[model samples]
Target: MKSLLSLLLASLLSVFSLPGLAQTPEAQSLLASVLALKPNAERGEAEFVAQACSACHRKDGSGKSAGNTPRLSGQHGAVIIKQVLDIRSGLRHNPPMQPRVTEQSLSLQTLADIAAHLQALPISGTIAKGPGSGVARGKELFAKDCAGCHGANGQGNQATFVPMVAAQHYGYSLRELEFIRDGKRGNSNRAMASLIKTYDQDDLLALADYMAQLPAPQRK
Candidate 1:
């Protein structure tokens, strides 16, 4: 009986533990469109504020609230481009962001420009730290489960379009992890979903807080 239960658990774990899937055709097209244009970072910055992105993300893209809005500062241009496209296409569901991106009538060039400006911003800002939550346990889990793809320092791999997770808002990051774990997020990564499923709410909270305190990805 014990062997059977353990086998079942292992199988379930494997189901969620698959590697990241190949990039979608839509992602490829978005990348191609961004590369085809010459973006103006200055203009992009202006538009980002004018478009009300700063309302939730802050003028610097550091997120207005922890675990609710994400820190976009110093994130890779490729990752930002992919996420924006996903939101626009309804591959990712963000009600507040959807109308903003669509109603603004932003063109591909404009999108790329915004991405460029965001990438140029420094990744320094105030983020909420979880007090006496689960720092030690979170650090251990992060190194074991998260460091491989997100980097030892959470810098994220631009080539793979992984967003930098360090210094992100604790609340927002926790929300995203919960959403992915529950299969609520549309652009969910299967591997992450599976891994997150193993953690309880406290575990996720600890992880988010730990990540929020890490240094932001350094500029090249």
Candidate 2:
């Protein structure tokens, strides 16, 4: 009986852990690029606020406490650069950023500079989604703050800077929201920054759950 139980547990653990352990080379490379980023605070921060990133993100980098916009402050530099590249090159899937890009409101160089800056800020906290009340509140907040950009189902705009928030890690998402709110992660779209500004802690956590539940983005 004991041998059978041990075997069962081992199998389960392997099934669960294989993906993380067997990350594709591409995945490892991409993650490595993101992790290697280092922020040039003085230059980057100045660039961040000057680029009008502060308008919607607020002066602190915390957004409106709601919306589909991502937080950038204190984020990995690699992630910021990757996202900026996506937005500038029209690789971002989120639909909303296309219009702004068309207007040349955010230039590719500006995106890079801002991305470098945002990666320097500190990470923020997320609101927890408890068993009962937290879930309900999270839903309400998601509807009010995140639906338009994130979609009701958290199917984010993939073409633009908007990411597919669903199925993301909660801690990552939580910190991401904080960066957006603080102007560390956003600014390319003033409208998005405005939307993100509405979120608070609890609202952020709820958003994380909603995002985590979403389907992962399809490979191109």
After TM-score superposition, the amount by which residue 48's alpha carbon in candidate 1 deviates from its true location, in angstroms, is 1.0
lDDT of 2 by residue, 30-118 (tens): 43343334435676677677766677655555444454444445443444555554454454444555555432575445554566666
At residue 63, what lDDT does model 2 achieve?
A: 42
Per TM-score, the best of the predicted structures is 1
What's the TM-score of each model vs. the native?
0.85, 0.40
lDDT per residue as tens, model 1, 1-220: 4442244334333432345544555555555566557779999999898777888888987875636688898998767877887788787878778877772577788888898899999876787666646878889889999998899999997656677888887778888988988887888777778899999988898888788888876676
State the TM-score for model 2.
0.40
CA-lDDT, candidates in order: 0.77, 0.52
